[model samples]
Target: QCIIDNVVDLKVQAAITSIVSATLAKAKLLCQDVSARGALVSCPAGYKPTGCACGMGCGSWDIRTDSTCHCQCAGIDWTAARCCKIGV
Candidate 1:
């Protein structure tokens, strides 16, 4: 009975792993970098901002409308965004 239960558990685990592998194989995380000469930068169409960076030694930043990166520091030289999307 114990051996049978172990075999069943192994089969279940294999099925779960197969499903996960197939899902991961079909999904791709695509990323890009976008930068601008001002305090704000926007990700390209169909992309969402994952993170932000600012020039002039500034670390204060936020995302606007889920697409644009806005730097909060004064006299900022540039702003950049790491954008990503899921693709097949």
Candidate 2:
């Protein structure tokens, strides 16, 4: 009976550990996703838009005007800029 109890206790402990580990992994993923979203939202101009249609083709850069950095998108023309479809 003592050995049986010990085995049950070990199984319970293992299950609890698994749950805790899974929860931690989910939390970590959430945090990373939030961080990435924030970075994309606050990115400077000329940096590729996070979800732009043109992908890396839409070169992005930050133009330092006075004391602040302004984000700007780059392309061959207005159509090229439009092609990026930023924020769409």
Candidate 3:
């Protein structure tokens, strides 16, 4: 009885693992870097900004509408955003 239960558990685990692997193989995270010569930059369509960086020694920043990166510093030279999206 114990051996039969162990075998059944093994089979269930295998099935769960295969399902997870198949789902992971079908979906992927695609990322891109966008930069511009100004205080603001935006991710491309269908992409969202995950992080941002600013030039001219500026550290203050924010994301506008979940897409654009805005640097809150005067005389800012550039801004960049790390954008990502999920795709199959």
Candidate 4:
């Protein structure tokens, strides 16, 4: 009984740790994205800044040369986006 209880406690701790780590990583990525966008917005025209590629279909809008702009919804249908069906 004692051994089982210890194992269960360890499993709970591991799950909590994993969730915290994942949340931190996501926050960090969001911060970086905001910073990059701010820099792009502040830059003047013809000024080139390099950063992550646009996620949507706006590939022509060069991140290096153009100001910061989010990808349009027309490009990718994220609403219909799916990961995996049941049995493929």
Residue-wise lDDT of candidate 4 within 1-88, one digit each (tens)?
4798889899999999999888766652111222232212223333333433343433433232244433333443221111111221
Q: What would the per-residue lDDT of candidate 3 be over residues 1-88, giving only the tens digit for each residue?
A: 4798889899999999999899989998999999999999999999999999999888899999999999989999999999999997
Candidate 3 accuracy as TM-score: 0.72
| lDDT score at residue 21, model 4, on the 0-100 scale | 88
lDDT tens digits by residue: candidate 1, 31-84: 999999999999999999999999988999999999899999999999999999
Which runs of model 2 end up more than 4 angstroms from their true locations?
A: 1-4, 28-88
Best by TM-score: 1
Question: How good is model 2 by TM-score?
Answer: 0.27
Which candidate number would show the highest lDDT if scored against the true structure? 1
Model 2 lDDT per residue over 1-88, tens place: 3798889899999999999888766652111111121112222343332222123344453323322222244422211111121231
Per-model TM-score, in order, reads: 0.73, 0.27, 0.72, 0.27
Task: Count clashing pairs, candidate 4.
Answer: 0
Candidate 4 runs further than 4 Å off: 1-4, 28-88
Q: Could you tell me the lDDT of residue 26 within candidate 1?
A: 96
Which residue pairs clash within candidate 3? none
RMSD of 4: 13.8
lDDT of each: 0.95, 0.35, 0.94, 0.39
True-structure lDDT of candidate 4:
0.39
Order the numbered candidates by lDDT, best leading: 1, 3, 4, 2
Candidate 3: C-alpha RMSD to true structure equals 4.8
